[model samples]
Target chain A: MDNSVKLYLPTDAAHIQTLKPNTVVQIYGTLYTARDQAHKRIAQALKNGESLPFDLHTAAIYYCGPTPAPRGKAIGSCGPTTSGRMDAYTPLLIEHGLRVMIGKGVRNAQTVESIRSHGAVYLTAIGGAAALYQSRVTACELIAYPDLGCEAVCKLTVENFPAVVSVV
Target chain B: MKIVDSNKIRSDVAKLITECLITPDRAVTNALRRIDTDSELEAAAAALIVENNDIAERERAYCCQDTGQAVFFVKLGDGVQCVGLRDALDDAVRQAYAAARKSVADPLTRLNTRDNTPAVIETELVSGDTLEITYLAKGAGSENMSKLYMLTPADGVDGIVRSVVDAVERGGRNACPPLVVGVGIGGVTETACTLSKRALLRPVGVLNERADVAQLEKLLLAKINALGIGVAALGGRVTALAVNIEVAPTHIGMLPVAVNLQCHSLRHGTVKY
Candidate 1:
């Protein structure tokens, strides 16, 4: 097994740049969960010059819509959604100081370029490995967009959440 | 005639939803075991995927968060009597999803139905007294990558080969690699798409019966894997585990081709009564 890097959230741009593709990382810290609907709302807010629900600078956003927890669990089978679907809204977030993005699948060319230019990195949690991944999410709380249900923005405290650096 | 209860169908459907989500089909597991990893990245991905399956099985949790749209293909015999079959199945889906706390998002409204009801059920009347129900929990990621094309006969099998390869290449990592490519050839537009999805119900690594069709499947599989999309589209040699093709007679002038990509999770099952 390759040695894994332990990364704390709100990572610095220099720290992100030091990481390379295929570097196995165990992430520890707060990750904001957002998917299609939440992204749209955030992008729309930015368009309207309104403040976002959460801080964007140096923050990591996980693209996921978790299942409802079943008794005693913090979250249920919370895995990454396809990152491509959020491609349209990603570049703008990166421009606004988002430093890390986590999801599965390849991002579009523009998003990749934004990550490169804006000093952000893209990581992929193993797609379909929700059950295993959920074990790492120590706590979860709904933060915004309660009406969106599963697609709502939530804050997750992760402990050694496994992922691979896909883009840097 | 064997009399099966509608309640049985409902319960079985519910069981299938849970079972398929938690444990992968045997063929898919076998294929995953056989994946050839060219890099540590691929190896790590394969390990995580395998471990995820085990965790899902041990914990009675879903292998994927999506848990997917409840899609069922039911084949019923003329002699079998289940008066409220449709309602029973719907009820079963609702109860099962509720028990699991799974999400079944409404397509138009994008709201969680919370119970995963109103399954996309496709039924056919068959000759025997047995009822067979095949369940597929199709995640949106790969489903969004599906495509249908209306081609001139001039395009031929080569055209299909090109289209399938191009779709996989274009899809890249989005649909999830180590995919199962289902190709539907020769039917009309919607029928071709349905046939493509139905073709995915076949076990992984199984080929079409016709010699020519099987050859086409083999060709398409090779080309897709050759694209180097890798596991989870991360960049590896094992892009696709299998390619299954289904063909139907079509009008002489028009040929429609549909492609449905199933991610490595490949949550599918069939129950017969």
Candidate 2:
């Protein structure tokens, strides 16, 4: 097997620039989970000029809604959900220093342009490979919006999480 | 007369839900392993899919987090008497999604039903004494991309092909590439949608019994793959794993076609009792 391109998270401009589309990569380190409901809340928070959940500059957003973890497991089936659904809120996040976005499926033209102009990269976690991914996460804990249930914002520490660069 | 207890139905459906959500379908896994792709990304994609199947099976973990809403298609036997069918399924869904996450929601209110209750159940009466249940934990990603088309009868076979292909194109990467495209041709709007979804219950790569319909399936599959959607829409030759088409006679003036797309995960199963 070819060695996967290593990408440690809290990614920098230099690191993000080197990555090319379609290249297989394995990410390691910290990220935040935000999906539909959470995105709306984030937008609302921004509008209100309130404190944001996590520092967008240093934290990547994963469009996911993981299952409740079983005993002795950090998480359960932590797969990526459709990224397209987040198109409306992504460009704003990109503008706020978000460098990396990870999820499955396609992004809209608007979202793609924003990623390009802002020098942000979008990665695709294999949609069906959730079990493999859950194993990669060493720790997971609630970050915000716990009432949203699985859609709540959470922090994850992953190691060797596999993905492919989809947009840059 | 055959007596099928509702309690047995509840428990059996619960087991089926857990199994279908956690275990990769045998035919789909086989197809993924059998992928012959020259693209490096395609090769990588296939490897991940194969590895995921093994992990899910070994750990008895969900293949994807979405777990989705429980959608059941049932064939009820004429002589088999079972009351409270919906109640039994509701119990089963509540039991199955209890530990996992609850995805079903009140659309207008956006509050989850909590236990993923009130599964979408469709039952048909058949001639035999056995009750056969097919379950699909229909997730949001691909489900969101699915479409319904009302074409004019003049659209005919070519129109059907065009409609199905168009849906895939629009779905693009959003529906999850390496898709299982289910085409429901004919019927009214509702039946067309149901048939399209039911087509997904067929084993991966299986053809319809009708020769012409089977031929259409082959042709449509080729066209979808040719779109170069690839796995995860990353870009490659294999966009779809299979295209299964189901058809019914419709009114002469209208051609109701619905396209249901299933991601590569393809979590589904059949239980007969």
Best-performing candidate as measured by lDDT: 2
TM-score of each prediction: 0.96, 0.97
List, for all models, the DockQ compared with the true complex: 0.74, 0.79
For model 2, residues B1-273, the per-residue Cα lDDT tens digits are: 988889988999899899888886777778778787778888788778788889988999998888988898999999898887779999999899987778877888788778887899898889989988888888888999899999997888899889888999988688766788888888899989999999998887679999999999999989988888787677788888789888999988889999999887788888888
lDDT of 2 by residue, A1-168 (tens): 259898898888887989988888989899899999999989888778888989989889999999999999988888898888899998888887788999988888999999989889999988878898988999999979988998999999998899988888
- Candidate 2 residue pairs that clash: none
Off by over 4 Å in 1: B1-3, B101-103, B106-108
Candidate 2 stretches greater than 4 Å from native: none
Local distance difference test, candidate 2: 0.87
Q: Report the error of model 1 at residue B199, Å.
A: 1.3
